[model samples]
Target chain A: MIVARIIDSIWATRKAEELNGFKFVLGEELTSEGNGKRRIVAVDIVGAGIGDRVIITTGSSGRKMLGDENIPVDAVVVGIVDDDCNFK
Target chain B: MIVARIIDSIWATRKAEELNGFKFVLGEELTSEGNGKRRIVAVDIVGAGIGDRVIITTGSSGRKMLGDENIPVDAVVVGIVDDDCNFK
Candidate 1:
């Protein structure tokens, strides 16, 4: 898993069925040490934007973002941080 | 840390007063064992679709999705999987 922040979101008028009722957000990639990275990506969820702390999933886990075995996905945000996280 | 997939994306013209450009996806939460979980949540990222494997970060990492203290968010997609993940 990775750390990041939802920077923004994009809304598409026409999309696939797999994207029905889904949400997306733009986030900056953060390292495990809790530092920000240079790359930025978009997420498909809701209630996140422009400065909220967040958790991101990468790798195969990211591919799993959708289970239709058809939708082409690479990354995904799984959980939202309710408060400061403790990994100790 | 948790694993999930980006199921879908949603677009809203009249959004929270907080949301501006965030993307959202409905993903089925997955456990560390590589198995899908019962609970399904929305993610915020793009370029991801159903059936695509993905990785997700939880806890404080999520709150950082937006970086904004005003918007309310819990999770955010950070990275897109090019292939599979290997943790050792």
Candidate 2:
């Protein structure tokens, strides 16, 4: 899992049938090196909001979080980070 | 999925119970710009060998490739690259 912050939400009315009812959010990775920023469109199942720190799982593992293997999702928000966790 | 090359193998005897019997291979991403090399430890399921180009899925989607959601895996080799596809 990678740490990221929800930047915004995506609204796509026309998409694959398997991706219906899933909320998509754009997230920017929070890397230690502070290198080039990488963004990912992740499915939100944890009710995360914009600006919230989150843990995202990518690839097939992300799709599995949605309980579907054939879903065209590559990233998904798995957990919301709290102050107790050290992101440093 | 991201394109990568199998660089080496990892052997860990003591790991999570759900991660037993899985072969972990080190992979380096094959990016277009040739930026800093990104390495990932991915589970091998498609019989990819060292030096072979393969496709990797990260996060839970990667875990789903193993047919188990509870598996403590972050990456998985899903396919072997051939000459037909343009990785450029």
Candidate 3:
């Protein structure tokens, strides 16, 4: 898990049906800038914040997170942070 | 900090303006199915799999993961797993 914040959101029409009832929010990853690698921005909608550590989902499970097997979502807020998540 | 699998997807219509354009994939939380907490399901992208250890973004950063801070996102896949993440 990483510490991050919700900055904004994105909007797109002409999309797939699997992503019909989901909301997408924008967020910034707060990891130490790696070897010249650029920071990342994500899209979510689980009511996170600007200084909270949140858990995210990706890939196939990201697909199973929903249940329809076709929505086109890649990342989702499976759980929220309520305590410390020291990965060290 | 958890392992999961993508099961399916969901679609919605007439949602918040913040969530305009984003893909939603389905995934299931894979944590030993503890205390029968109704195994959780999530929506994500980042091209994960049914048996992958992934890193996700949530909360405010979940929002900032994106650029626009008004699109309405909460969780996102900022990075993928390439090694072991022993959080203990």
- What fraction of native interface contacts does model 3 preserve? 0.00
Put the candidates in lDDT order, highest first: 2, 1, 3
TM-score of each: 0.40, 0.54, 0.40
Candidate 3 residue runs with Cα over 4 Å from true position? A1-3, A33-45, A49-52, A83-88, B1-88
DockQ for each model: 0.03, 0.11, 0.04
lDDT of 1 by residue, A19-49 (tens): 4566655565656655423333445554565
Q: What is the lDDT of residue A61 in candidate 3?
A: 37
> Which 10 successive residues of model 3 chain A have the least lDDT summed?
A31-40
Q: Please state what fraction of the native interface contacts candidate 1 reproduces.
A: 0.00
- Full candidate order by DockQ, most accurate first: 2, 3, 1
Model 3 C-alpha lDDT per residue in residues B1-88, reported as the tens digit of each score: 3444444433333333344465443334445643221122233556665455555555546555567554344555555567566542
Q: Please tell me the TM-score of chain B in candidate 1 relative to the true structure's chain B.
A: 0.64
- Compared with the true structure, what per-residue lDDT tens digits does model 2 show for residues A1-88? 5567899999999999998999999998764355656888988877888998776666665565455668798777765665454423
TM-scores for chain B, listed for all candidates: 0.64, 0.89, 0.60
Better of 2 and 3 by lDDT: 2
Candidate 3, what DockQ?
0.04
State the displacement of the C-alpha of residue B37, model 2, in Å, after optimal TM-score superposition.
10
> Chain A of model 1, TM-score against the native?
0.63
Model 2 chain B worst lDDT window (10 residues)? B10-19
Looking at model 1, residue A52 earns an lDDT score of 72
Error of 2 at A18 (Å): 1.4
